[model samples]
Structures are given as structure tokens and as C-alpha cells.
Target: MESSCPSTPRWNLDRPFLTGRFHQEIKGTSRFASDAKGCPLDSFSSGLENPIGCYDGAVQELIVIDDLLFALVGIEGRYISIKRVHGKADVFSFQVDASMDLALQEIAKRIFPLCESFLLIDEFVESGSQFKNGLVNHALAAALWALLLDYQAMVAQLEHQFRLRRLSIQGLWFCYQPMMGSMQALSTVIKKVSANNYAGSAVLNLLQSQAKAMAGDCAVRSLLEKMTHSASIAYLSILERVISWFILWI
Candidate 1:
């Protein structure tokens, strides 16, 4: 009888957001890297196991694809993706059960809240003359933010309809490498936009364009007006911290 406990053997994103032991253990598993024939299971035997999850060496078609996914996904949590992990000709459409899905959500909710708490709560203090948000100083804040965003991306993938169309870029959460450099990639994208012609406020135009491109394969989420107002209030608050500093100097 197959165990109904959601065989997340390789994806136990259970409680902790990140751990060093998880990274060390995940380094071994075999991934679907080639057209090789055999039980993919045998490939996983020797690898070590970690608490976050164990892997059998998740492989990919080209090294670049692995790197790309890692940058896109690994920043949030530890990932080990082998493109053809199960010998399936098709990639993507990898479905996780509802239980696994909800567990991942729970992690995001609990751990990620630290960020909002720091930013919104009164406990954090101003850093220096520049008035930096105390939240940024928390070592875990960035990790928490990464975990939150990555979880959202993973959830975004799950929220998708996995029809057989071109193995869409789902399953990004499992792609991993130490320091995947997702931020650098994101930074470069912004730099390119700023360097382009008509740079002023063109950023907004560029975002609109990109949003249009993403709309083809993604759903647009609408936040309630109250939510929008709350977000704006927070942004204004972050900005106010800086503004207040400048005002003090003036």
C-alpha cells in the first residue's frame, strides 16, 4: 500500500526555512541528466540525506538550465532539481499533493511573517543617521524574505494549470545550487531597463510591458483596496524613514 503521507522524501520543506545540514545532504542524489536507461532509483542510493529533504541528484539537459532555475528559485529555499528525475520524456507537470502544498504554505506564513513584523512592529529601531530600517539588519530577514518570495513562486507554480503545453517553467522551487545568484540576475534586469532609451519613468512602461508578457501564461491577481492601501502605507513608511533623515539634515 502506498503511504498517503505525501512522500516528500526529497522536499521536506517542513518547518525550518533553511539549514546547513540540508545543503550537505542534498549534494548527492542522482538527477535525470541524460537519455540513459535504467531505474532512476538506483541512482539515488549512495547520496546523503538532509532534513529539508533528500535528493537523488536532480539533473538537467544543459548546465545553464540548471543554473537558470537555481537563480530563479533557490534563493528562497534549498533546492535539488534533476530535470529528468523519473525518466519521463516530458518535463514540468510535476504535481505535489494538497497536503504538501499546504505545509509549504504554512512555512511561508510562519517564517515569512518575521519580515512584516520587523517592518510594521515597534520593536525594530532606526539604524543610523541615514535612518535605515532595523529590519534589514536582522540576519534572518533577507533569508526570510527570500523564503517568502520563493514560496510564493512555488505556490504560483502550483496555482497553475499543468496542461501538457511545452513543460512550462513550473517546479522552479526544486532547482538549487549554493548561492544561485537570483538577486544578481534580477539586478541585471533592472540595470538593463534603466540603461535603455527613454529611461525616466520608462521603468513603469517597461513593467507594464513585462506584465503583459507574463499575462499570457499567468493569472493576474487583484488585491483588495484595503490591501492596496495598507501596502502603500507601508511603502510610504519605509520612504518616510529616509525622508525624515534628510529632513533632519536639512
Candidate 2:
């Protein structure tokens, strides 16, 4: 509730962020973002191409909603609905007859679920009261949703492994990587948010529990390392560890 170190500069969401949990945004990596030559693995022979695969259709719809969010952000709730409806003037459909917005629909749908305030293990730690408020606001029902989703995905992968199917574990990587980073930032935020109170202790307990669900920092790193086979775990930064803790949270 009280700002202990208000002077401590927080990230400015108005502009692009270079580091922190928003690193991917800084690099302009969107769901539709492509490789050097422009081939999103989405359309490849991978299972991602399926509109019905693992709720792929739903994911695309969410991506569209995410874009819609940027338009609605910072608008006051008072008359905001009218403002949004009126704000539709500037909206224009990209009429590219090429291979243009083909992926737009899908990407937009994918990011829809994440548009709301997402909690990583650390994002909450930064703003203790706000985080707790969000938790209470959401009714604590989806507390383990992210972790459960990952658990299910991992289980699916294990199933595929057992069936001798060549399914990629990274199919769901996009869903978790940023989630992990965001959670870490939240953890740091929680410490600052709580300052000196029982909120801090409660948050620590919650965070530790979340970390356990995420398989802790070591297990997370191990899993990612094994899957990507990358010696450099770029997403394993401090913010990422906070996220891992959250996913581990039960």
C-alpha cells in the first residue's frame, strides 16, 4: 500500500524495455514475429499448424484480443466502453493480398489469455499489495492454472515420448517463457511492495510454493537445457527464476 522506495525507478511501460521481464518485447518478438527469412514455425509441419491442435483456434483468437487491448489500455473506465467503440475509427484491416496477416488472426488469438495482468513468481513480489489484491480479485481459482497447464503439457510430451511420437516439447514454450520472466519481476516487485510487513512474509511463502510447482530454479534450468540443448540459457535470468518459482507453485 505504502510506497517504500518510490524514488526507485521502475520500468517505463510507455516505451520499449531493454531488459527485465519485458526483454522479448524490447526485441520485438511477437507471436507473429518471424525468423531471419520469415518462417514462423507455426505454419511448419509441426503440430502448431493445426487450427484445432491444443486449442490452436482459441490461441489465435486471443492474439487478436491482445492487439485490441493495446487500443484499450490507459483509457479511463469512465466512458471507456464508449471510447473504445468510438476509437474504432483508427482501426484498419491490413488488406495485404500476399502472405500478410494470415498469421495475424492466430497470433492475436494466442495472446488473448495473457492480456490480463499475468503473475509470474516475481511480478507479485514487486508490488505486494497490488499483487495480493489481484490474487483476491481473481478469487484464487486460477492460482495454479499456469503451472497446471505446463504440467499437462509436460505430461503430454511424456505421453508422446512413450508412444514414440516425434512431438516437440517446445510446442508450448511460447506460453511459458515470458510467463516465467514476468513472475520473477513480480517477486522482486513484491519485496519492494511489502517493504516491512506480514505481507512480505506471506508473499515469500506463496513465492516459495510457486517455485516448488515450477520445479525450482535448478529443475527448470535442467528441463529447458535438455529440451533446447542450448548451453546458453538466456531466459534463465533472475526474472526467469522468479517465474520458474511461480510455475513450481502449487
Candidate 3:
């Protein structure tokens, strides 16, 4: 009886996959079998005695998937480093399925904006004396920073899972897709506030409104509520001071 599965082709492992130099070489000829010892597929027919070949093949696929995930999240990994050019948005160093590539691009689009928003706020807090001097702005900035820290932690957790080989590219995408809408909304609000030069209570009020609008998302709502509470501390203190002064006057 013949096996229904197609035979595994021999591949020359002399060149690195990261450089993409092996693509044409693999496609052009079966010359890969010339160096039989270097081929990953050589042991596939060797049966149970050579399990290492199976491991090697699996590792190769994992490496490619891991590299793609790292690129999607704009992180540097062992195999790939994502780069951005001024004229071009993001240039992927490796090629994959066109549909998968497009999906990763869309994920990157949603992610980088939030990253940029966090950087924008950090820069404002760091460089602008006026922003730093205001108590309300300071509190609001701290709250926003806290929220972004949680977001960063979530990404880090995903990276950890990938490293452990517990997550696949599809799993990573599925996990991230649900949160993209809430994150993008936060990014938009932050950018608008930054662009308009909104400060203090104005910023806090907008965030509160945004949080209310996102109430259906429990995780987002909880994060936003915590941020709002932190931001409102200064406002609440001022209100308390006024009430105490009015009581004394009465």
C-alpha cells in the first residue's frame, strides 16, 4: 500500500531562511539532495529510530511562525526584526501567505497607533513645563500611563506564551483581535486630546466619556474606570477644599 501523504522534499540547510536566499534555491531544483546529510527531510523515512528529524522539521516551522508573530507585534526576535521607513509604513522582511500578511499588517496598524499615543503623552509630560506643573494634568498623565502599562503587560504575556510554544499565530491573532477595538478607541481619544492641546479636567472628562461608551467591554471599562479615579483625585481634592471654605464662611 502507498502512503497518501506526499513525500517530503529534501532541503539544503546551508543558507539561512532569514536572509530569504534559500527560496529560489529550494524552488529551482532537487539539487538539494546532493548534500544528503544536510537535508532535514532525510530521516523522515528512517522510522522510529530517528525522532530528531521530526523535531528539526517541527522547529523549523515554529521558527517561521514565531518570526511572523514577532514582526506582527513590532518586536525583535531571533529570526526577524521589523523596520519602519519614513515613506513606507512598515516593511516586512519575510514573505508569508498573502492573506496572513494582510491580516498582520492590519494588526500592526491598530497596535502602533496606541504605542505612538503613549509616547506622545510621555513626551508631553517630560518636556512641557506647563503640563508638568499642573496637578490635574500630572494625575491624568499618571493614570494614562498606568493604563498603557497594563496593555504592555498583556503583550508581554503573549510573547511569553509564544516563546513557550504554547501559542500559534492563529491563537495570537485571535487573542489580540478582540482588544483592538477598545485599544484603537483609546488611541484615538488620546491623539485627539493631544492634538487639540487639551489639559487637566478636559482630558479627564473626555476619558470618562470614552469609558462610558466602552462600558459593554468589562475589561476596558474597568481599566478606564481605574484611570478616571486616578485622574479625578486632584479635582476631588479641590472640590473638598472649596466646600470646607464655604462651610467656614457660613
Highest lDDT against the true fold, candidate: 3
Tens-digit lDDT string for candidate 2 (24-124): 11122232223233333343223334222234444533433323333122111110111111222111111111222445434433432332223232233
Per-residue alpha-carbon lDDT of model 3 for 83-159, expressed as tens digits? Answer: 22223211122222222233443443444443334434444333222333356766766766565576668767877
Query: What TM-scores do the predictions have?
Result: 0.25, 0.25, 0.53
Error of 2 at 195 (Å): 20
Model 1: what TM-score? Answer: 0.25
Give the Cα RMSD of candidate 2: 17.2
Q: Rank the candidates by lDDT, best first.
A: 3, 2, 1
Output the better candidate (1/2) by TM-score. Answer: 1
- lDDT per prediction? 0.29, 0.33, 0.51
Candidate 3 Cα misplacement greater than 4 A, ranges: 1-133, 215-219, 245-250
Error of 2 at 39 (Å): 31
- Backbone steric clashes in candidate 2, count: 43
Going through the candidates in the order shown, the clash numbers are 11, 43, 0
Candidate 1, position 83, lDDT: 27
Q: What is the lDDT of residue 203 in candidate 1?
A: 32
